[model samples]
Target: MANRVIIVGGGGGGAILANLLQPHGFDVTVIDKSTSHFFQPGNLWIAFKGVSPEKFLRPIPSLLKKGVNYVNDEVVSVDLNERRVTTRSGRSYEYDFVVLASGAELDYSAVPGHRELLERFGDFYSSPENSLKLWNTLRGLKEGSFVIGVADPIYKCPPGPHKGAFLASELLRSRGLAGKVKVVLAVPVPHAYPSKTVADILEPELKERGVEIHTFFTVNEVDNRENRLVSLEGEDIKFNVAVVVPPHRGPSYNISPAEVKDQSSYVKIDKYTSNVQGFDDAYAIGDCTNAPTSKSGVTAHLQAEVVAARLLGYDARYSGRTNCPIITDGKGTFVISDYDHPPIKVRLSRFKRLMEDLFVATYWSAVKYPEFWSPIFKAYFDATDEFIRRGEGW
Candidate 1:
C-alpha cells in the first residue's frame, strides 16, 4: 500500500504537492475550506487593468490531479502526535505524513480603524471583491493623493505595496491625471523595498516615474475620520484614496504540539529541510511557514517541489528561492534571490512584462499538470540561474 499523505489547505503549495506526489503512487488528499482556488497574483491585474475577477478563479477540484482526493471542508485542527486531522465536519483523516500549506490570513481588524477604511476605500491585496472595489474606486478618481502601502511588515508578497503604487501611478498617467494625482508609497521598512539590491535598482525608477516613498512609516491606525494614515512614528499622511495591505497572521485552526508554531502562529519549520521543527513526518510550506524568504507563490511552488522530492525518498532541500515580478510603466522585471545570493538586478523589459502576463494563463496548468510543465519550468529556472550567475545588473 502507498504511504498516505494528508495535505492541509489546497492552496498553491498544497495543490502542487498533491499533483506532484499523486502520480508517483502516494495516496494524497487535500483539504481546503474554499471550493475555488484563486490565482492571487492576478489580483493586481484586476485592480490595475480592470480585468474580471472570474478570469483568475478555478474550481479547487479542477486544479487537482484525478488521483488526488479533494475534501471541500474546513480543517479545524491537526493532532501531530496521533497523526490524525480533524475537520469541522467531524471527519478524521489518518496519515503517515502531513504538510501544512494553509497560507496566511489577512487580518484587517488588527489595525485600528483599518476595517472601516477598507470598506470605504478598498484594497487590491486581499480578495477578489476588494480588488474589484478598488478598481471601481481608482476608475472614478480624477485627481488627488493616492496613498498605497502596507499596515504590517510581514504580509504576503513583500513587493505588493510597491506594485500597487506603480500600477496606480501608471493608471493615473494613462488617464492623463498624473500631474494632478500624487502616488505616495509608505512602507514599514527602512528602505524603499525589503531587498536592498532590488531597492537600489527600483528607487531611481520610482523617482523617474514621480512616485513618493516613505520608509519607516509603520501604520499605527487608519484615521478614517481625519482622512489620513497615522504612523507609529507619529507622522501622518493625508490621502484622497488610501489602500494599505492589512496585517497577516497564520492558520486559523489549531495545530497540535503548540510549540510547533511561533508567536505569529506561523509554522516553525526547518528553513532548508521544510520540516516542521522536531517532526520529521510533518512539513510546512508557503505563507504559513516561517521560512526566511519572501511570502510569494514562487517560494511556495519551489518549496512544494522540494517537499515532494523528499517524500519520494530523494534528497532535496529548499534554497529559499523567491521571484517577485515587478511591473511599472508597462514594463516588468523580477527580483530573484536564493539562500546563496541576494536579489539580482534585472533590467525592466517588455519581454519580462509579457512573461508576467503570460503566467496568469499558464498558472492553472502548472499546478494541476506539473508533469507536463516540469521540463519547461526547469528550463525557465535554469535560464534565471544563468542570468544570476553572470552578475547581470542594471
Candidate 2:
C-alpha cells in the first residue's frame, strides 16, 4: 500500500503538497477550516484597491482532482501518537506522515478595542472583513491624516502595506481624490522598504503619492475613546481613517509545552527537514513554523515541496532559495533569499515591476477562490501542489 499522508491546514504549502504526491501514487488528504482558499500575498493589494475573488480562490472539491479527497473543515487537534487528526466536525482521520502547515493567526486583539478599531478604521493584515472594511474606509476617506500604521513587526507579507499605499494612491489619483487624501505610513522599521537599496529607489514614489513616511513610530495605545491611534512618541496622529496592520503569531493548537516551539508559539522545525523537534513522522512547514523564512505564500510553497519529498523518502532537496519580485511604482527591487545568505537585491525594469504586482495578485487569491475554476489561478497553483492523492488499488 502507498503511504497515507495527511496534511493539515490547506494553505499554499498543503495545497501544493497534495498535487505533488498525487502523481506519485501516494494517498493524500488536505484539510482546512475555511471553505475558500486565498492568495494571502494579495491582502495588501486588496486593502487599498479591489481584486476579484474569482481570480484567486479555487474550491477544494474540484481542485483536489479525482484521486485525492478534500476535507473542507478546521483541524481542531492532531493525535501524533496515533497519527490521526480530529477535525472540528468531530471526525478523526489517520495518516502515516503528517505535514503541519496550519499557518499563523493575526493578533489584532493584542491591541485593545482592536475589533472596533478594525470595524471603524480597518486593518489590512487580518481577514476579508478587514479588507472590505479597509476598502470602504479608503472610498469615503478625504482630507485628514490617513495613517497606515503597524502594531508590531514580523508581519507575514512585510512589503504588503507599502503595496497597499502604491495601489491605493494610483486608485485615488484615478479618481482625482489624490489631493484630498493626506496619507502617512507609520512603521517600526527604519526604511520604507526593509532593504536600503529598494527604499532609496521607492522613496520618491512614496513622496509622489503624498505619503509621509514615519519611522520609529510604534503603536502604544489605540484610543477608540477619541478615535485616535497614538504612537509611542506621544505624538497623536488623529485620523479620518486608520488602517492598522496588527501583529502575527503562530498556530495555537494540539501543542504541548514539551514539544519545541518559538517564543511566539510558532512551531520550531529544523531548517531542511521541517520535522517537528523530537518527532520524526510529524512535520510543520510554512508560516506555522519558525522556518527561517518570511511568512508568505512563496515560502509555504517552497517548504511544501520539501515536505512532500521527505514524506516520500527522498531528501526533499530544498536548496533553500526562492525569489520574489517586489512590485512598486518605481523600477522595483528583486528580493531573493536562500538559507545561507540574506535576501538578495536586483533592480528590474518598470514593466517587469508591473508584472511582479500582477503575479502577486494572481498568487495570493485562494482564500475566497478555490484552485479548480480559473485557468490562470490553476496554472499557478498546479506549479506547486505536490502530495499523494488517495486512489484505487492501494
Candidate 3:
C-alpha cells in the first residue's frame, strides 16, 4: 500500500506538492477551504489596475495530477498525537505524513472600524466576491487625500503594500490629480522596502509624484468618525482612500508557538528540509514556513521544487537563494528582491529579466500546451488533466 498523505492548504505550496507527489504514486489528498487557487502575488497589482480575479484565479482541479485527491473543505485543527486532521465539518483524516501550507488570513479586526472602512474605503485585499470593491471605489473618487498604511509588522508580502502604493500613484498621475490628490504612506519599517537601492529608488518615485512617506509609524486604530488613522503615538493622518495590509499569522490554531511556530507564530521548519522541528513526516512550505525569505510567488515556486525532491528520495536541501521580479504595469522595470528580515533588493538585469520572461512564457505554455514529449521542460509542466486521470471529486 502507498503512504497515505494529507496536505492542508492548496494555494501555491500545497497544490505544487500535490501535483508532484501524485505522479510518484502516493495516496495524496489536498484539503483547502476555498474553491479557487489565487495568484496572490498578482492581487497587489489588481488593486488599482484592471486584472479580473478570474484571469489570475484558477480552479484547483487544473493544477493537481493523477493519484492526488482534491477536497473543497477546511481543516479546523490538527491532532499532533494522533497525527490526524479534523475539519470544521466534523470529518477526520488520518495520514502517514502531512504538509501545512495554509496561507495567512488578513486580520481586519486589528484596526477599529476596519470592516466599515473595508466596505466603504475599499482595499485591494478582499475576497473573490468583493474583487471589484477597490477598483470601483478608486474609479468613483474625484478628489481626496489617500492614506495607505500597514496594519502590523508580519505582513504576507513586505513589498506588496509598497507595490500597491506605487501602482496607485500611477493611477493618480494618469487621472491628472497627482498634484491635487495628497498621497501619504505610513510604513512600520524604517525603510519602504528591505533593499537600500529600491528604497533609494522609491524615495524619488514618491517625491516626484508628490506623495509623502512616514516611517516607524504603527496604525493603532482607525477613527472613521473624523476619517483619521491614529498611530500608537496618538498622531493622526487623514485620508480619502486607505489601502491596508494586515499582519499575517499561522492557520493551525492547535500548533503552539514553542512546538511549531517561531517568534512571529509562523511555522518553524528546517530551512533546508522544511521539516517541522521534532516532526519527521510533516513538512511546511511557502508562507506557512519560516523560510527566512520574502513570501512571494517565486519563493513558493522554488520551495515546491525543494519539497518535491525531498518526497522523491532525492534528499534535496532547500536553498536560501531566491528572487522576485516586482513589475509595475509592464511599462516600468520589474525590481527583484529577496531575504526575510530586510529584503535584499535587486533591479533584475538583462539576464535575470530574460530568465523571468522565459519562465512566465514557459509556465503559461506549460499549462495550455503541455508537451508530453518535451524532455527539458516536462518536469515543470502542469495541467488540469493530471488530476482527471486520478479522480474528480466534482
Candidate 4:
C-alpha cells in the first residue's frame, strides 16, 4: 500500500509537496480552507505598480495534480498521538506521515484600534484587496507625510514594508510631489532588513531617496482620530497616511498533546531537516515553522523541496537559502542569504530583472499548470540545482 501522506494546508509549500509526491505513487491529500491560491509576492506589485490581482490568483482545485485528494474545509484539531486530523465538517483523516504548512494568520487586533485604523490608512502587506485599495489611496494622495510602520517583529515579508516605502517614494517623485511628501519607515528592528549587509546598502539608498528610517519603534496601538502610531514606550509618530504590517500568529487549531510547538505556537522543527521536534514521521514547513528565517514565499518554496526530498527517503536538507528582489521604480536590488550568514546585496541589472521576472512566471506555471510548464521546469530545475550547489551565488 502507498504511504498515506496528509498535508494540512494547500499553500505554496503543501501544494508543491503534493505535486512532487503524487508522481512517486504516494497517497497525497491536501486540505485547505481556501478555494483560491494566490501568488503572494505579486501583492507588492499590485499595491504600488497597479498590477491586476487577477493575474496572480488561481483556483486551488484547478492547480492540484491528479491522484491527490483535495479537502476544502477548516481543520478542527490534530491528534499527534493518533496521527490523525479532524475537520470542522466532521471528517477525519489518518496519515502515515504529516506535513504542516498551515501558514500564519494576520492579527489586526494585536494592536488596539488597529483594525479600525484600516478604514483611514492604506495597508499593502496583508491581502490582495487591501493592496489594490492601497493603489487607489496612493493615486488620490497629493502631498503629505506617508508613513510605513511595522507593527510586529515576526512579519510574513521582512522586506515588504521597505519595498512599499521605496515604491511610494518613486511614485511621489514621478508626480513632482517629492518635496511636498515626507516618506518615513518605522521598523521594530534596529535595522530595516534582518541583515547588516543588506541594511548598509539600503540605508544609503533610503537617504539618497530622502526617506526617513525610524529603528526600534515597536508600534503597539493606532490612534486613528489623530492619525498617529503609538509605540509601546508611549512614543507616538504622526502621519498623514499609513501602511502598517500587522502582527502574525499561527492557526487557532495549533493545539495538541504533542510538544512540537514553540512559545509563539509555530511548530519547532530542525532548521536543516524540517523535522518537527520529537516527531519522526512529522514535519513542518513554511510560516508554520520557527526556522529563524523570513517567512516569505521564497523560503517556503525552498523548504518544500527539502521536505519532499526527506519524505522520499533521500538525504536532502534545507540550508536556509533564499533571495528576494527589492524593487524601486522598476529597478531592483537582489538580496541573497545563505545558511547562518547575513544577507548580502547584489548589483542590479537588466539581466537580473529578466531572471526575476522569469522565476515568477515559471514557478507559478510549474505548480498551477504543470502540463504546460513541465518541459520548461525540467530545465529550470536543473539550473536551480546548480544554483543551490553554488550556494545561490548571484
Candidate achieving the largest lDDT? 1
Least accurate 10 contiguous residues by lDDT in model 1: 385-394
lDDT of 4 by residue, 1-394 (tens): 9999999888888888888788888999999999888888887789878999998888887778878899999898887779998999999999999888899888888888788867665478777898888888888888778888888889887778878888888888988889998899998877876677678867877878899999888899988889899987667899888877888887668446647776677888898888888788888899988898878777777787788888888988887866677766555666666566556546555676677688787766567544455456447545644554655444
TM-score between candidate 1 and the true structure: 0.97
Per TM-score, the best of the predicted structures is 1
Q: How much does candidate 4 score in TM-score?
A: 0.91
Please identify model 2 stretches exceeding 4 Å from their true place. 232-235, 256-258, 317-322, 329-331, 357-394
Candidates 1 and 4 compared by TM-score, better number: 1
Models 1 onward score TM values of 0.97, 0.85, 0.84, 0.91
For residue 306, what is the lDDT in candidate 2? 75
The runs of at least 3 residues in candidate 3 whose Cα sits more than 4 Å from the true structure, single-residue gaps closed, are 256-258, 262-264, 329-345, 348-394
lDDT of 1 by residue, 133-195 (tens): 899998888878989868788989887888888888889999999999999999888889987
The lDDT of each candidate is: 0.89, 0.70, 0.68, 0.80
Tens-place lDDT digits, model 2, residues 1-394: 9888888877677777777778788888888887777666556556666755355555655555467767888787777777888887899898888888888887778877666778785666776666766777787766666777887877777677777677667767777888887777888778886666557656777897788888777676788888777877766667677777777788766664335667788888887888888789888888888877677766777677677778677886454554455565555545555566555445456865776666655453432233332356435334422211111100
Q: Which stretches of candidate 4 lie over 4 Å from their true place?
A: 368-394
* Clash totals, every prediction: 0, 30, 0, 0
| Candidate 1 vs 3: which has more lDDT | 1
Q: Cα lDDT for residue 368, model 3? A: 25
Against the hidden true structure, what lDDT does model 1 obtain? 0.89
Colliding residue pairs in candidate 4: none
